[model samples]
Target: MNQASSTTTSGSAAGMHPREFVAFIAALMAVNALGVDLMLPALADMGAQLGVATANHRQWIITAYMLGFGSGQLVYGPLADRFGRKPILLATLAGFVAASVFAAGSQTFAALLGARVLQGLMSASTRVLAVAIVRDRFHGRQMARTLSVAQMIFFLVPIMAPTLGQLLLNTLGPWRFIFYALAAFAAFVLAWSSLRLVETLAIERRGSLSIAALGSAYRLTLTNRFSAGYAIAAAMTFGGIIAFVSSAQQIFVEEFGMGDRFTYLFAACAFAMGVASFANSRLVERLGTRLISQAAVLALIALSVGHIAVILLGVESLVSYMLFQALSMTCIGLCGSNFGAMAMEPVGHIAGTASSIQGFITSVGAVIVGSLIGQSYNGTTLPLAIGYLGIGIAVLGVVLVVEEGRLFHARQAP
Candidate 1:
């Protein structure tokens, strides 16, 4: 399909106005974040009630969901490519609603985890479809800017979800209500998307669902240097994010004694990310995605070093932790959309499968990386800091190789 109208146009070239399109896609993407965050405050309680013996094992709740989310992307991408984006998205959202209800009613920890995995498996479509649809409608700097804006909006969920979840737990009885809330919100998104989201994948652009066609699309995506490299780099960065999330309750509530303040602290960090995303949206087209994201990666490495120094100096206080965490998240915000846009830039012809493969790699790889850091949590921030530092160095190396030792060179429009 022809590129959506120029980035200068009022509405997206994808048929929806910019405001509506970003909001819709953001809401869709937020579904995944909401499913994750809304359970944070309740992890301890859920573990206690479900007879989970070890604190570290409670993280399995998050890990299981992530695994399902990652693997499900591999399936949705090819199906969406064959069937179309809208239908697949709607079906997945419907499944997400059912899964939420199933989770809410679980009588055992194993059953609850099973339901969460199913919920994540279904919600994976939102990530795949949102990226694929944007690829269908935009490219290059336009794509980067659009994703930044959507990320800005999507971060709202992370900022509010923990608080919302905590509120429900305090006022609405037990942790089960959190799952019900997830169901309610997802149902609304399902209804809204069903009504407003136009199909960006033109019928002529739809790919075959045959195994050979699927393999070829995935192969092309993996073989493309920019696509594969940026995806891996992004995955490294995401590992830091998931590590923070998987161990957040322990770090804030158990280690720092934040109590009810944990959600607010989390919200502060998320708000910082949201602010950075908005800044990236405005600046990416002007400064270039490579220049901005590369700078952010370097900044993350520096911050990680400082963070580790503070931890080792025995000066690790809540205030210091909050400042460091928020700043680190700011760097992540700057990097994420740009990295994704760069990866998708070279593979628009197979946007669905490409999005799927990349999403799977980033999600699964991040879970592995995050799991290592999370499981190593020992009532300290040292592990998390080291994770960020390692990820930053790895990402920088990959970017250097991908760009052939070049850095910050902007791409002209095709």
Candidate 2:
């Protein structure tokens, strides 16, 4: 692999191979998942220490971060387009590290929530740039395959993070130390990226930084039927996953009495997702994005329906819940990367702005839906199961609109 020098005008990968590029991008994006998943094991301890009033109120920690993460995407997308990816990414990483430190020292629940929001806002750069970078280098089905491979690696973080969090909580004996660990991890990523990543956006191809230009880009993105439809579909499907994440700890610990075993159960579901993503990487090239995603949506809907029926019948056990949840996540694993690639496929010229708009819509929308479902937790898995079913059906409708009622038909090659 060729190392990126500071002197290049048009950014190159510095002779980085596809696997290495995929690994680097996956690591960057995984920070977002790590930020959320790693905190799950510590939520109860932190909430008690910080004087949280209710168990449900503790969810504000996750919700606050998501809101800031979503809102900040709008800012970073445009700036990355105007200023270039490398500088913006580096700055954002630094901000994330600082916010992590702030959160670690927070003495009040409100203060910790605020710091988490800042950390999430800063981390938005990693998510947005990771997608923009992939779009920078590839388009269409190849982009779908590349993203699937990256996601397959990214899923490993979710699989291991909770266990890691649990270990840290056991050894450090304080939840705040987790935030300190987060700061250290972000610092390492920042250092590695600073030394290796080259700017992918060329100077001449950059859009103007004026409000008028921004308005035009926004207009173009929203008015494009393909991009807009797929964005909505992605948002709804994404909501289902967010809902599961928000409720997983409660479902495993309180509902099923899994106790300390919750992390392993969570990891089991994550493993399913990782396997599904790897399968998507292999199948996307032959089956195409639309077919794979469409089929996965149907499978998700079926699993959700079955899960709801079992719950209603009073036959749902911990094993049954895990089985259904794993199947649902597997379907999500198949849909996510493909849906994102399809949405961004036609908007590569304005990749940063396009990604920002889409990211904003999906993240904010999912947060709203997920928060509602999470807040409805009644010491049972009913709400989560119904939420998955509702979101799956909603996204299928959106996908139909995107495809103009055509399912599984591949678009012409670019």
Candidate 3:
């Protein structure tokens, strides 16, 4: 019930209760995932209506948004520092709603892609500001716990969003209405944020835009050998996930002939990620981040190799594909957080800038890798399988260079 807007309280963030603050932050994080996952089931319908014929070309719907999202990450943190969080956040949320509406009304594929990019550019604020807001409220273990809880909520979106989009497509009988649903969700968030949020950055603490300083921080982030290696490795690890998502619709619906059941199977594949994340959380403290993540990478390489062998031997089936997909996804889930944490470990002082830059790297870099793999789809899962193997090897190569030919060492993460 407290309405006071002070950022000094230890128990509550500003004036809102702790639960509300966490939920609000989690909701912000969820919007980014929802933006991506909610459109998966509708991509086919959108492509047909927009006259996009090639199955791979339809992935541009997802790729365009990701490109914008990746590009936007570099600016939002610095902008938030200079302009204060609330104003910039409110503006971006409004932009998100408007862009969503624009997308909903698009008559051509190009126009829809442009709108989706704009929507993604606006939605980028949700990820930047959500973490920034959490940092403003808590530190150390509390901060970690808050992020963990928010991420738990964020992970749920991928599991359920495809099914939600399928239902919308079924009832609304058009894919554009999915954009309308997205717009409505953004509007609700905008209202909730406008009504309840307060400025977290203090006037004295507000930073001026300094290109030299920003560049220096970026330089420092990239120059740290171990951190840089982990950052790139993490991005490569994420690339596999992006590739899977980009091609999931085509593989499930068209190639596998799953039809309406695509969402259910897709959801099952996504579920493996959540389970792996849970297992990682319980095991990381004892096993160490490097060891577990390295193991996962090895598993990815092994799974991919085995998958390709099966395909070559003419033993591939929908069940085999799903099994391999789920196992690979589980590896990615295990790698995602551990690799990121390790990458950030050496850059604690410049965590914000490092996060922004690393986020850009992961997203844009993954998009590049995913686009290549997705475009290589040839009525078989071989390309995706190869993509996963490549990712695993690339990660291992980077880790070797950074660790001096080491794997699963007990030494502390840099």
Cα RMSDs of all predictions?
2.0, 3.2, 3.9
- In the range 1-414, model 2's lDDT, one tens digit per residue, is 122232132335433566778988898988788888898999889898999979888888888989888888998889989988889999999999999999999999989999989988999888889998888777788888888899999999989999999999999989998998899999988987888887788776678889899999899878887777787788787777777777888889998899879999999999988999999999999999989999999999999999999999999999899899999999988888988888887787888999999898878887898898889999999999998998889988988887778898987423
lDDT of 3 by residue, 36-69 (tens): 8898998877888899988789999998998988
**Window of ten residues with lowest summed lDDT in model 2:** 1-10
**Which portions of model 3 miss their true places by more than 4 Å?**
1-22, 134-148, 195-205, 410-414
Model 1, TM vs. native: 0.96
Model 3 residue 270 lDDT? Answer: 86
Where model 1 places Cα greater than 4 Å from the true spot, the runs are 1-15, 411-414
TM-score of each: 0.96, 0.96, 0.90
Best by lDDT: 1
What is the lDDT of every predicted structure here? 0.90, 0.87, 0.80
| TM-score result, candidate 2 | 0.96
List the candidates ranked by TM-score, beginning with the highest. Answer: 1, 2, 3
Worst 10 residues of 1 by lDDT: 1-10
